[model samples]
Target: MKTETKIMASILIFIAILLAGAVFFLSGDQKTMSQGEGNQLTYKIDYSNGQKIGSDSAKIKLVEFSDFQCPACKGFEPFLKQALTDYKNDILFVYKHFPLPQHLNAKTAANMAEYAATEGKFWQMHDKLFETQEQWSALKDPTEFFIKLGKEIGLDETKSREAIEKSLYNNLISRHKDEGINLEVSATPTVFLNGVKLKLQKFSDLTQEIQKQL
Candidate 1:
């Protein structure tokens, strides 16, 4: 009788282990599905959509999803500018918007930059926003500040103001964010060399990566 009881206890333990594993696997699958909402994840580069500079036919594409209000992005600007200047013929640099929710002025600044793009002056506004990020980023309403920046970059004040008020570039900005999300970009200054996402610790890291592809 005692031997029979031991056998039954072992059988119950084995069954419990199997049930636990099944639960774990199902929960793991559910977590993954819930995170991405059961949709197919797409990760592809749109070569022409973002603000681009350098040789159109260049073999290396350096794409950066950045926010103007991010200090780290600002800190990385000089290095990127130097790189752009240094590799004008070899590298095609594309700038996409990825304004984090924590930064209040980032999206507005991105809109102004996009508006400037329509006037054939995106890079100019891009520089202006990063240059004055500290000042305008703190204002209660950065609309006037951004318009002022637009003016500094030769964007028409009335048109810039209207665009900001109307949020004309919202769709484009959202699309950029969506693309970043698909690529699992959770931080500003997420850069991709060609299609492979880069883990950038510094400008030297970027230099080495670019050299490898060149």
Candidate 2:
């Protein structure tokens, strides 16, 4: 009977520790990152390279490290997009590249988006890529397909080919990927809000956090 009581007390203490951690999470710890569900980490944030939208002076910076060929990134795209639209006036939304090696076309996709950025069409190309990701994601080579996408979004096809062929934005994409690694991003669509990594499984998870900051 005494042994049972001690075990029960230990379990209660463990539960209390978990509750305290939840409270800390609610307190808005800004220096830590969660790599998916259970892994928590702390890493520095850098945005010297990315396509940006929204308020330049906003207190909240919502940053996404995404891979073009990543389906999980695609799945989360809508929620992230809605959050950006909803919080456009209240936060700075920046999209960075984190193309995985397995996704053959991912790096090319990033280059094409950056190519489009030069023509002031980054977001347009971005939408085009994700919208048609399934079509070109599996190709043995996707550069020509990317040029087709470029033309679809009003980018000059010949210039797009030149950009792809020359790999003009590869350096920029490389820098973005390196930055994501530095931030300890282990998966696609890793997002950080005001320096705190968010576990966003639904729209509410994001909006509620944004509201907390606002």
- Note the Cα lDDT for every prediction shown: 0.84, 0.82
TM-score against truth, every candidate: 0.79, 0.78
Per-residue lDDT of 1-214 in model 1, one digit per residue for the tens? 9999999999999999999999898676553233322353324677787888887789889899999999999988888887777778899998899999999888888888899999999989988888888898888789988888787767899999888989899999999888788677899888887767777778657777788888
RMSD after CA superposition, every candidate: 6.4, 8.0
> What's the lDDT of the predicted structure labeled candidate 1?
0.84
At residue 109, what lDDT does model 2 achieve? 86
lDDT score at residue 29, model 1, on the 0-100 scale: 51
lDDT score at residue 88, model 1, on the 0-100 scale:
81
Model 2 has a clash total of: 0
- Model 2 CA deviation exceeding 4 Å by range: 1-43
Weakest lDDT window of 10 consecutive positions for candidate 2: 29-38
